[model samples]
Target chain A: MKKERENWVDMAPDALLGYAVVVLALVCFMILLAIVVAGVRILTGMGAA
Target chain B: MWHRLTLEDVKVIGHYLGVLVLVSAIGLVPPLLVAVVFGEWHAASRYLLTSGIFLIAGSGLRFLRVQPGRLSRQQALAITGLAWLVLAFFAAIPLSMSGHYANYVDALFEAVSGLTTTGASVVQDLDHLSYADNMWRFMMHLMGGLGLIVVALSFGLFGKGSASLFTSEGRSEHVVPNVVQTTQFIGRITLAFIALSTTIVTTLCLVKGMEPARAFLQSLWVSISAFATAGFVPMSQNIMYYHSLAIECVLMVVMLLGSINFTLHAEILRGRIKTFFEDTEVRITAVWLIAIVMVFAASLAASRLMSDLPAMERRGLFMVVAAYSTTGFQNVTTSQITGSFASGMLIIAILMAVGGSAGSTAGGIKINRLAILGKSIVATLKETLAPDTARITISYQHIGRRPVTPDIVREATTVLILYGTTYIAGALVGIASGYDASQAIFESVAMASNGGITSGIVVPGMAWHLELFYLLEMWAGRLEFVTLLALMIQLVVSATPSSLAMRLHARRAQRRRS
Candidate 1:
């Protein structure tokens, strides 16, 4: 357990999670942006009808 | 039943507070160096004076120290509650001397806003303000974002009762077993993200033809603000000044990371991707973001507010992220938000009030509490559908499976009620100060959630009473009701005549029993 904990700390955990979160955030943003575009289209189509 | 605070109690609290203040004085040095680098001698003098005051005051309190021991919960609450206000008082000294604010109160407002990581400001002519002053503002953000207690605890400044001090500052989970290691981990992660982001943003700014020196400074400031989930901008135009999609996208990513729970970050660090995704806070935040974005986009479409699709996508996606993260980095102007985006402003208000995850830099009724409350409703429905003696259990995945007991639900509901009450009271105060209902509510939610998105009501020379109340709101909101209420109750109990008489009576009863 001690050795395992040491390896974890030595991995520079900051960079590991920092870069991962950046990618995850971008992916989430893209999906949310698509939802917004679709919602806007549906709303506008209803209004025109 | 409560014991009256004695002189020794005051000294113990003061001793810890003094250490915090003296450590915070180190914050002044970087800004002082910036003032010297830029040849802003006037600002340099003010920084020197404030440093002197902090040292003298800190030493005076340090003299009153008692025997070092573990802190009682009340003492921790008092220290945590008073630290922000006291630091703000010392922080305002330099800003008040900067000649940018209209009065001392305005400077205090700016200091409080910065220290709370609320990002609201009342300084006049921010565009022309000295670089040293801007540095100081973002410094406040970085310090306040990690939390003053967290910073002190990270340095192992408090000899005992560090865990109580940690929780009193509204943080419950420890990423590591030791509170000190947990804080150190938080500091390390923040620095890593800020460094990476500053590099990306600086390159983007240079590609956009900004001067190399100015690009570096602006990038650094924005990176710190975004990673801190703080809203202050070096430029008066806020995020609009960049107008670069890449820069905005980068900031949005950083803001999202900042608003996530630190324990989740640790899980991700340990390669526990499944746990990260399965956490209740993350799941609820994903749902809330999607729902609010869809509603906000529909409102924009119905109102015909930004008829262009690309413009809507850019502003819509960014504003939702900004408001939802409670970062308050605005790309849309206040006029636009108040005028055409009026319907959208209400959506932003809801996002701010609901806020980001618990145990993070972001403030509000956190998504964790909301998740517990949300699960409670489902549990209630399950109970209703079942026959008698149908044993039911409800649990949700945070770090792991945690039962959502009645105590958890009650705790969540109490905080929700407290936030709601404060929002209503603040809005009433705003309306009484002669603003319209929509503006009043929007501004109130913004201040209370530490979402610094303005609606043209918070300005250089606003009403003093309104400004004072907003300052209190930001302070109380950051403390998250419990610690602030504890401090307020302690004050009232100490000061009121009835409480004093009761204390005497209790003392006599103790004597008779003895």
Candidate 2:
């Protein structure tokens, strides 16, 4: 059985969707950022070494 | 009949397309003038032909039969979708005709990039190009940056259906009672600033190191790019080409200002500027810039990427603002950046996807939409804690409204859906084109957000299919995706399925009745 549909009448109509889109896009972005962070960590480590 | 963009409320979408073409045609003049100054008659002549053709076609369509009635809601979506395609096609012809651009799709892609104020360039070498070509490329940012419809309405007014035309272009605010007047205000303010900015920045650059002539030219291009939030640098090496941190800092300041609404700028200029600080877009964007930079800085700190906190903080913050604003300017090369730097850049990709304030030259989901979403999230969280009898309210000011509405939320959500789906779908296609996952994803975000920067996905003189994909992505990005999807849905619905089904079903019902 399906859950009751939330009344978006009181909610910001675009917020959920906007959040979702941003999150999805952010995930991809964050992954790239993590990789950069790791690489920088390694490079700086080697430099000091 | 449709007139050019006028009336804050009453015109159809078709008129916006017509207005953009007409405005782009008119905008071609300055570049043509520049071409004359530089002695490139061939470039000037080709541009003249292109502009002439665009004007005739646009004006002709503007005069087409438009009944004085409520425009179909679908027309707004249709016009937005078709406008980019139409502009790209006509705009490309001149560049190709001038013999610089080899492929029509490349022409289309560059034009799309220019008009969307996306800074992506398929062109590799810029050193040999004549002044006219360079100016023309820069002018695309100017026209796209300020919005052609707003530009047209500033110089001219349309009767009756003006409001529809304005709404079709997705304008919600009215700075004046009449949109034409508002357009004039915006243009006057913009032109004044452009003059001041160009003069000051050019002199400063000249004082520092650049040749006077080159500085002047760069100033003109940077002024347009800054105002439009477009990331185009006249030189091939981008902002880094100058190797001047001062210039980058100056350009970044302008780009940030450009990302905010002109109305906000006006408010600040008028000295009633507290409104500017209070703006949801402004505050959120500030927070976003700070938060993203901190996260990356922390990530770098953990990884020990850059030894100095102040230096990493400055570069990280700069990249954050640059990406989020969709200006795509960077003083650093892809080669020098680490994987952490790539992450920081990707964060910028997400920020670009979020874009700038609405009713402005900047593109993406915009800060207000995010603001509204933030409120909604708070409201959701509060519902669990509040008593059943508690009367609660949520409010935020947009262009003019004090309390954001459910309708606004719905519209913003629909646009987000369109933007998200397009980014992912484009990435999938790029992957299909044999690009790596990271490159495909990065290019997808870049193209879909109208953020021009890629991780080697876009090669110089690319294949036609890939060029077409980028062109379409840029167009859809400029319109925020839903408008394009709405147009496609209209066509698909009109051509084959539902109409045929309805007709056949009606016949069966009639036979049953008989």
Q: Judged by lDDT, which candidate is best?
A: 1
Give the Å error, residue A21, model 1: 6.8
Residues B145-193, model 2: lDDT tens digits: 7665566667764544456545656566767678787777677656765
What C-alpha lDDT do the candidate models reach, one value each? 0.88, 0.69
Model 2, position B26: C-alpha lDDT score: 70
Candidate 1 Cα misplacement greater than 4 A, ranges: A1-18, A46-49, B501-514
Give the lDDT of residue A7 in candidate 2.
27
Interface RMSD of each: 3.6, 11.1
DockQ of each: 0.33, 0.03
**RMSD from true fold, candidate 1:** 2.4
lDDT of 2 at B61: 67
Q: Per-residue lDDT of A1-49 in model 2, one digit per residue for the tens? A: 0221242222334434433343343344444544454455455553243
